[model samples]
Target: MRAVVVRSFGGPEAVEVVDAEVPEPAARQVRIRVAAAALNPVDAGVRAGVFGGAGKQIGLGWDVAGVVDATGVATAWSPGDEVVALDYGMVKPLGSHAEYVVVDADAVAKAPATADAVHAATLPLNALTAAQALDLLELAPGRSLLVTGAAGGVGGYAVQLAAHRGVEVTGLARQDDAELVRALGARHVTEAAPGSVDAVLDAAVLGEPALAWVRDGGTYVGVIPQAAPAPVRGIRTTAVEVSPDGARLAELAALADEGVLTLRVAETYALDDAAKAHARLAEGGVRGRLVLVP
Candidate 1:
């Protein structure tokens, strides 16, 4: 097998493709022959020695779409099952950047029948982040929610999901992304955050700067862990840490199949060109996330 690994944590140059032994599934785990994986800013952070560098050479991938090559005794999946997974609640030496990855059976769900490997790979991490953030708000159908960085991956999903739940959505994005965000179901799109909303989902990592956008006594959901602003005037603030849930992913995949969710891929790179992919992501203005084909 072959995988992209960070030989030494630093810049994109540190990422290298190397031969690796094929991994096997453990009890309650499934081994996937990865077809595609999504690249996130977190991958760059991890590559730059952030998040403790995984303490050694570490593979960089979390969102994957592939075919099941093998499964564990307790796993419900079968060989040849097409799946999309978030590799978050599992222990492993390498991530989905490899040709094969082993993940907990409970962390993967059937991929959208309407999507290919690349599109499906883009769903798990960002979609789960949006879904979990909305879950924290617990907002009722006629309420309003604001999504910062609304054109980005997580924010884009947040707007669509909130709208689908009948919540009025307002998205903060670049002036150029107004139409795109509006198409995703946001009722309003602006470069600046509104004065107040029933709740705010800070997908942009606006952190303390975004607190003013929420109404007093309302909820503020953030993506950046431990970086959300302090609650003020009865406002309740929480940061979301997305967890792998095959059931939730199944629901999301249904939405995608139903055309309620749309995914965009900014670029696709070969496995060996992982460094170039990271460099492009860092350059910014990427319409959506980059994908890696294994």
Candidate 2:
């Protein structure tokens, strides 16, 4: 099996594709024949040693859409089951970027019926992060919510999901992205939040500035775990450490299939071009996820 990994930390140049032994699933795990995997910012963090696995080969990739080739005992999945999964970890020996990767069976969900592997590959991580962050905000219907970076992957999903729940979503993005943000169901789109909102989902990691957009006694949730701003004015503050929930992912996949959630692929790279994909991601201005097809 060939997998993307970083043996030493630096820049995109540190990303390497190396041949590795095919991993086998342990109890409650399933081995996926990698069809497609989405390259995420976290992969860049890993490559740059942001998570700190010094001198160790740290695998890349987190979102995978593929077929179940093998499963450990007591798992509900079967061989040949098409699925999507979040291979959750900052550092690992192998990841979903490989030709074959093993993940806990409980993290696997059926792929969206309406999307191909490339598009399905974009779903797990960003959508899960957005959905989980919304869950933390716990805003009721008709309440106002602001989604920073609303044109990006996670923020785009946050806009749609929050809007679908009847929350009045305000999308903060680049001026040129206003149309796209509005199309994603944001009640209002802006380069910045105009007034205080009921809550702010800081997908852009604006930190304190975004927190300031939240009204007193409201909520603020950030995607990065433990990176949330300190609470003030009786407002609740927290960060979502996204976890894999097969059941929750299943609902998200269904939402994608039903058109409640839109899946976007900024570009696709051959598995062997993993490094090139990382370089492109580093360039910024990517509207959707960069997918690696094996």
Candidate 3:
């Protein structure tokens, strides 16, 4: 199989496509014939040595949409099942930026029927991040929720999901993105600092600064691990690390199929052009995500 590997921890140039042994599923795992993989900022983080050891080389990807090709005996997935998954965690050796990848069956969900593989590949990691962040806040319907980086992948989904739960959403993004944010169900979209929101989902990883957006006893959820702001005035601060949950992914897919959620594909790159894709993402401000057709 062919996989995109980070040859060294430095820059996009460090990423290269190489021939590699096809991985087999372990217990409770299933092998997927990958159709597409989506790029996230975490990929650049991994390339820049945030998650790698000195001189370490590893496959790079998390979001994947593909079809099951095989399954381990303990797995419930069967061959030919179309799926999407968050295919990596803290200990990534191999990942989904490859021709084939193996994932725990419990972490794979049927891909949204309304989307093709490339579009479906954009959902898992981002949507899961949004879902997990919202879970940590435990907001009730009609409560005000503010999402930072609301035009980006995770924050975009946060807006939609929060709205679906009947929570009022105020999206913090550039003025240019107001229309798209509002289309995604944000009741308000602006660059102004939040005022007295019940909760703040800091998808932008703004750290302590975002805490000011939450009301005095409200909640602040951050994406950066251990970077939540200190609690003040009885306010709660939580940081979330997105984890794979097939059941949750299935529900998200259902929303996509029902037209309650929309998938956005900003650009597509061939597997060999992953370096260029990384460069594009690093440039920033691209709406939606970049997909790699493997």
Candidate 4:
């Protein structure tokens, strides 16, 4: 098997594709024959040693869409089951970026019936992060909510999901992204958020500034783990450390099939060109995910 990893993390140049032994599934786990994987910002973080796995080979990639090729005991999945999964780890010996990757069966969900592997690859991480962050917000229908970076991956999903739940979503994004944000179901779109929403989902990591947009006694949820701003004026503050829930992912996949969710692919790179993909991700302004096809 060939996998993407960083032996001595630094920059995109540090990302390397190397030969590796095929990993076997452990109990309650399944091995996926890699079809497609999405390269996320966290992969960049891993490449740059942001998570700090020094003097060791750290595998990259978190989102995977593929077929189950092997399964461990007590798992319902069978070989040839098409699925999507979140390989939830910052540093591991292998990841979904490889030709074959193993993940817990509990983290695997049926792939969206309406999407191909490339599009499905974009769902697990971003959508899960957005959905989980909204869970922390706990806003009811008709409540006002603001989503910063509403045009980005997680923010885009947050806007759509919140809107579907009947929340009045206002998207904060680049001026040029206003149209797209509105198309994603946001009731309003702006380059800046107007203060005093019932809650704010800070997908952009704006921290205190975004927190201020929430009204007193409201909620503020950040996407990054442990990076949320402190609560003030009786407001609640927390960050979502996204976890894999196959059941929840199944619902999201169904939403995509029903047209309540949209999947966007900014570009696709052959697995061998992963380094090039990282370089492109570093350039920024990518509207959707960059997928790697194996």
Off by over 4 Å in 4: 191-194
Residue-level lDDT of model 1, residues 1-294, one tens digit each, is 999888677888888999999988999999999999999988887788767745577778999999999998988899999999999732235999989999999999999999999999999999999999999999999998889999999999999999999999999999899999999999988733545688899999888778787777988989977777898878898999889999999999999999899988999999989999998988899988899998
TM-score of each: 0.97, 0.98, 0.97, 0.98
Q: What lDDT does each candidate get?
A: 0.90, 0.93, 0.89, 0.92
Error of 2 at 9 (Å): 0.4
| lDDT for predicted candidate 4 compared with the true structure | 0.92
- Per-model RMSD to reference: 1.5, 1.0, 1.3, 1.0
Task: Return the candidate ranking by lDDT, descending.
Answer: 2, 4, 1, 3
Q: Give the C-alpha miss distance for residue 169 in model 3, angstroms.
A: 0.6
The Cα error of candidate 2 at residue 270, in Å, is 0.8
What TM-score does candidate 1 reach? 0.97
Which 10 consecutive positions of candidate 1 have the poorest summed lDDT?
87-96
Put down candidate 4 lDDT per residue, 88-195, tens digits, no spaces. Answer: 999897888989999999999999999999999999999999999999888899999999999999999999999999999999999899999999999888633445
What digit string (tens of lDDT, one per residue) describes model 3 on residues 126-218? 999999999999999999998999999999999999999999999999989999999999998864354479989998888778777777888
Mind giving the per-residue lDDT tens digits that candidate 2 earns over 52-136?
A: 9898989999999999999988899999999999999998988889999999998999999999999999999999999999999
lDDT of 4 at 183: 98
